[model samples]
Target: MSLFKLDNVIQNYAWGSKDSINQLFGIVNPNHEPQAEIWMGAHPNGCSKLGTTGEPLSEVIDQNKLDVLGGYTAARFGGLPFLFKVLAAETPLSIQVHPNKRKSELGFERENAEGTPLNASNRNYKDPNHKPELVYALTFYKAMNGFRPIEHIVALFEEANITTLNIELNVLKAIGDSDALKAFFSAIMSLEGERKEAALAELYAAHARPAKTVMGREALQYSKEFKQHYNDDIGLFAPLMLNTVELAPGEAMFLHAETPHAYVQGTGLEIMANSDNVLRAGLTPKYIDVPELIDNTIFEPIKPEDIRLNPVLKEGKMSYPIPVDDFGFDILSATDESKAQYLRSAEILFCVEGVATISSEGQSITLKPGESVFVSNNSSVYQYQGNGVLARAYN
Candidate 1:
């Protein structure tokens, strides 16, 4: 493989902050401060900065200027379907969902039939693909994953004395499974006037003090945002009302298609299968296609507390987890006494910490903090030498 540097994009979302400095050591400190996303993938939206010839990434990749990645990624993903990013969410992200490819094609076509612009805000379909994401937390990450079990939600609604939400909850209880949950979500999204207003009132009445102090405050903040957008969204009460999961550094959660989810807060390195089709189910100001979301959602009640991971090893210079083809990343830590291990894969390794040197065959490169390198599948066995942390990505 030739020597070509990745072009990284820096994004400053609301939920971002720095610990000691900004983008120096990848040491992200969150206090509701500005954060940055270092994108090193081939998505048109944002691409990493190239090392040579100060130019946008797309130009280099387009002209086959980067001899290393020219033919590699394109052949694998059939045109880089995945967008690699590191998000520092100091504030809770708007609750949203992605549609599967099937749903996207159908929805895009349906809209075309109705004369909506292909890039219209109301256009929910971006492409024909399902996005399954796996986010491994580098720092402590908190997010709401999956739906709250219908029965559990029903019980919670009753406990809070939420008459309006409870009425819908009861209806959901009668239906029992995820499909019923989908129906319930649809009803909430579509109902207007008196019924919607009544539902909102009940949700507000049922709002509970979040046991997690920080998140509780955030829930209140989003509740206000929800009111501003939907006016009477009963789902506003949903955040404080559902289960929340806090992942310690190194843990991860996988969300398959139609699994209702939301990232409440925290910062982390996120990876997903190559796709961007989302079908939101509220918690956002984005387009909410209630009927379409209902049709595509799998909806069985899922709780955030249930997220888990299977840790493989952590004693040596590195740790490797069970690999699933979409993408795999492992945390690499080194000590003075640690010995470098050989690595060779159709992958990209990123150094997020102390200095380290990666050598393969007879070629080698030293990666400073926040720098990364791409290793071709044809590359020889490689080794890491230094004291630091590294994350490797591959399909």
Candidate 2:
């Protein structure tokens, strides 16, 4: 099979942040502090073209008869199974939940029957597909990734002296308690003016005070920002509020469908199953589907640390600390010319610094800083010679 090189496109998404003064250093950064997207795969919403000539990747592969990228992806994933994006959160994203396969299928049909456009911002069922996502930190990335276990949040609420949120606390006490959390979310999301405003005032005050736990500190920090973006969004009081994660450079996290989450701040490399079905609940002016988010989301409290991936190892020739089936990322830093371990799958190498040459099957490509290349599966035994850092990804 011929190697199908990737055409990396630098896209500026709107969700990016201005306060992130550090993540923008040295890259071809957006002056408007726009969210940056480095789309490496093909998903029609945005697919990287072959070159500046504007030929779509789907068309290129269709004409070439190349076995490097499967035809299924060319049809379904729009030419690539993975879509890599660099998400830099300028402001808080909406509190949202994705629909699982069954739910998405049903919802898509229901919405279609109701005559909702596929492109409408409020349309939660864009497709009947489940999106499982993974984020690798380019810098320190912070987010609320999942449902926090109720007890932890209850404890946090107590430590912060915000006793008024007890309506949710009592709900969790019931047996088969999922509905209680759902009810709490509905109450908050559906609530209006004065009553909700008073509740937010108390919650905001508690989040301001210092508490002993890590969750406590995170709660206070994020609550201030959440309030800044959404003054009285009742969803701010959900149990998911208690869990906030911050990932350092080189770390990663995975989020499956129906995992209610919000990207809080910082820059990172994100890849997901190719779909965009987000049902939002706050912090932004984007569409909010209160009923959908309430029904689809899970309300348990989560510890920020649980989503973090521990470094596996850095031994021998490769540092293969990060792992995923869709793609595996390896950090390579060579002090001298060295050969990468041979593998069965197709791979791509991105040079981080200095100069490096990848050669296999008598074909070679020279890579410099910010340059990457797709390696044929038949060209697995390549020698990389230089002094620099690199990331190698393959299926």
Candidate 3:
């Protein structure tokens, strides 16, 4: 009654890898379809099914809210507050930002008042909940997070010498702060006609040559790589303006609300608030509301170390100091000395390496790499009794 096995959904999106998930999780892919993400929570869009009875996780939760989620969490969130996913990106995702709680509520309400259908391509807000994510790399993961320092951004643009962007570039150089970044970025993303062409053309030509600075070389390679998929989309220049970092296996990063970011490549375990709202900037065919994205984005520069997390290790567990209340993550090393966790909120345990058997009261479930189990708060306590690495997701 406390432990439930989940039959998760695999999202097949174009940016996914056809082989990575299969290779890492033993998930068979005979059709060779792109396996983008694995949905492992009670989200209505892709609710996981109970392995034993095939009932949707949402229904199960709705029917037994307090029993499943515990008194405090049920009272606070009304249901599950987070969604868990295994995301594998073979290419760049859309350049995008998530709004904060207040912005998300306003946008969702505004769209509803206008009668914008939720599924409409132009609809921006999906729910009134903000999505703040923490990703732990399963492989070498590459991403662009936050903005580059204004001076560095100016230097790159100055070096690229895009004649069309001269005015905006000069404006940014003159102001040289967050406000200037906002104005400059907004203008650049909103570029039209002859000016857009001239700027993009100059950027390609400049990067197409041998590199000048180390940062320039990175910009050159990423721009070329992005072009392979998006083909000169304005977002392709993201590397030139944003801070880029590669997270090694077992490394982690946090993407907070209003932060501009994009996943460039590789696989990771991502946990976020149970929301789908997204405001796109570039890198896809998706509708981009540039003004909304700009409004929601934080135009501040951050070093790779700022987003790349360093966890606190204690008692065979690693915990991230997340700022949000919607979700919490911990990695438990289960060996002969495994400690039992007293469940105060609902939890999901996913085995990532080796094999482990989780036991509660008198029941047990064996999990292999990629296998996950949903644990109800009614269980109160549970422990793992094997040698393996397990990622724990909770409220």
Candidate 4:
């Protein structure tokens, strides 16, 4: 195959945005259901299809793995190793972590041996691959990523005057270790019944007062929003403990396995290792596997600069660097001076803005906004023209 049009899958999750995806794709939903994600890969859970024919992309890849995917990619990953998505989050997602490869394999095997149903809400691991993700902000995006510095969290809590949290905060301050952070986080998640309700009430009252610091103010703002959506949910306090990340358009962040994260609000392009094994801690009506989450979560503090991926401009493409062999991503902007680009592996190109014409060998496809095309590895050389922004995922 040279280049084939892909019919993507749109996931309608509760926390999704109403207007973003619909507006991007130019679809008007009469029922006004949330459009959470538009998936553009061969992942079994929500696989994309060949345009008009309704043939599954996964089936096509399986039948011609070596030709569709390069020989090296096919040998290493068996099929497509990456899943691409356009994610729109209006409300906060669950506080969650994904397991490393070894842990994921172990957990998947254990659950399978225990006869856990694949569709069971309690199931933790869906596949044995570790999910390391990169998010490119399409709009102003807000998220909670990794643990904040222990000292900062303690000071925030002390200033907030939450007497209930003091004990756990004190333990964290005293130990000053990763284990202490785990213990403190665990204590917060374990709060129950009247105690949990009281803690939430205290948290709400604390945010009611004017915050002294910028981070404190941010925490208060996020907490207020969280409370509005999920009243009495203990996970609402997560903003106080996790680093709040705000991404401008064109900025990107990479999330490795075992990193605790939640997308607070935003629309973005996300690409990750093809896995759906999420171990959730709290902040959802879904299953909260506290023990599993704690085991997989890394307690190390992550600075804002650490997760940010600075793009390198070369030719007309801006490449986002990620330290993974499973996938490569770049933003291709075609102007009048743009030139032909060569593909080393199978690639998926999505036009986010403007209009672009992509040509491979003798065949060409014109992609408008929200349109995507899958270029097979057999098509080695491709050229682009017309003014537009294209997000490309390869290998």
Candidate 5:
């Protein structure tokens, strides 16, 4: 089949919203479960099934890699290189960072040699691939991305009179900016016993008063919200340390390897390399290997302009250009009949809003909000008719 309607899996993580998916897409949820993510890919964790044949997408792709993934992608990546998802975060996600390709490969191999089971809760790397993802906001999405500049970070702590980090802050002031940032972060993560608790308490008390500055207000607000959920986790200090971002509808952010980030709230579409390797720091009860996380992470400040991935209009579609070859993203909107180019690689087309029909190879498939179809590389050129907003993912 050139086009297969996809039956995806919705992951019910504890941080998910109870009604976001249902209210946004009209998906049935009689159980009122928290729907965290709708996975549309061939990952072993949650492989999509073909609606017509009930065959697993991964097995089907293995049957005909070249036809399904196209020649270059097949040879380069050996299979589908990307995973797509609709991620909804009602509460804060873990403050985490992904390993780079080299680190992930080494970690995966080392863990295998150590006889650590793949399903082990203490496992740090799940696959040998790096996960660099883009989050396209469907609603007002809030998140923390990367570290703030050294001066800004110092200013906030100083203004709040947070003496808990007196020694670390002094080191930051003593050393150069770049080296100091990493050392300070490592120190913060390694904080133990009364030191950790005292710091959290001091920070909490500091935020009790209304912020006196703009940045201060943002930090205090996020810190308070996070403390509500994770009072014990030191990650509540993330807002004061990392860059806080709130993307308006239609805006997007790209998170690369070695960046410390977390999805605070709201809904978005996420596309990434087919990898599950995540090394967490805080804001979670999960096992955290602080040294491993610090070793793999790149401690650098990301400018505000660099956080959001600006769209480049190309051939009637708004393309989100990424640095990696594992995936590509584009937003296409049509209110009338629109002709599109032939498939260059395997793709998943998701209708974000309105109704539309995809026609190719003498066949047609109608898609509504929250519906999607997998277009194999063998499919002929396709066209869309009717009103809709579609997100197309390809390599």
Candidate 6:
């Protein structure tokens, strides 16, 4: 098979940006609702379609898994292992983490046995696969990822004069990183009613004061934003406990399983394992599974530099290296003076900027900004040439 155009699925979540995805895709928003994500994959929940035909891409792949997903991938993952998405976040997302494969399988089975509906809003696990993701910033992106160093978090609490949390802070200081994190997190998530509100009010007032450090300032800003959206929810205090990271366009970060994270704002290209399972802790109206989140979360401190995936630049492509065998991600840029590079895989390409013509042996397709195409492995080798940036996802 040659290259097939894809009709992507757009998800309009409440926290999505109003203009980013629409502007990128050149679509006029009639309702002006938030356009959160454009999903391009075979996931049953939000599968992409073959352009014009309206046939689900998942069905097409299942009919010819060997040709579309390749033999090894089809045998191992049973389908496409990765789900590609364009995420535009105007408001902060929930504080959430994903389980590992084993935990996911177990949780999924348990939920199934309990007769929990698959579409239940309170469902914790949606699939029995681990979701490891990477986000490539399309604009200035801000997120809170992983845990901050214990000493730094302690100092932040001290500086902010959060006396109500003194007991939890003391416990954190007394124990090791993991136990301290669990204890501190448990204490925060356990706060109820008036006590939670009172604590949040105090934290909010403290955050209003000018912060001395960069992280502190960012945390305060995030806290204010979270408060505006969620009122006095305890999740507003997450910024103070997690590492705040800001990524410029082209920079990327990898999120492994059990690493708690929340995307604060901005648009990005995200790719993850083909799973919808999300273990949310707070910062949203969704179900909060405190024990599950705490049990699965990795409690180690993560530096911004440590989580960053520096791209390896080739002639015309920049590959973001990850440890997972499920998928690979790359940014392919072509110019008038560029050479046509060969690609060998069942690949999906989305043009984020400029116009580009991608050609296989005797077939070719032109992709404009926000347009995407699926290239089957059956196409021996294809090359693209134009002046634009394209994101490629493949196994």
Alpha-carbon runs more than 4 Å astray in model 3: none
The most accurate candidate by lDDT is: 3
Residues 348-374 of candidate 5 have per-residue lDDT tens digits of 999999988888888789899999999
What TM-score against the true fold does each predicted structure earn?
A: 0.80, 0.82, 0.98, 0.96, 0.98, 0.96
As for TM-score, the candidate ahead, 5 or 6, is 5
Instruction: Point out the worst 10-residue segment of candidate 2 by lDDT.
Output: 316-325
Per-candidate clashes, comma-separated: 22, 8, 0, 0, 0, 0
Q: Report the candidate with higher lDDT, 1 versus 4.
A: 4
**Candidate ordering by TM-score (highest first):** 3, 5, 4, 6, 2, 1
Lowest lDDT sum, 10 consecutive residues, model 6, at: 336-345
lDDT of 3 by residue, 162-273 (tens): 7788888899999898999999999889988888888889988986788889888887788889988888698977888988888999999899899888999999999999
- Regions of candidate 2 where Cα sits further than 4 Å from its true position: 1-7, 17-25, 29-35, 52-54, 64-66, 70-78, 161-164, 173-179, 207-214, 238-242, 300-305, 314-328, 341-348, 352-355, 376-385
**What are the lDDT figures for the candidates, one per model?**
0.62, 0.64, 0.90, 0.88, 0.89, 0.86
lDDT (10s digit) by residue, model 4, range 33-90: 9999999999877999989588999988888888889899999999999999999999
Candidate 6 per-residue lDDT, tens place, 273-295, comes to 98888998778888888888888
Instruction: In model 3, state the lDDT of residue 268.
Output: 94
Instruction: List where candidate 6 sits over 4 angstroms from the true fold.
Output: 337-344
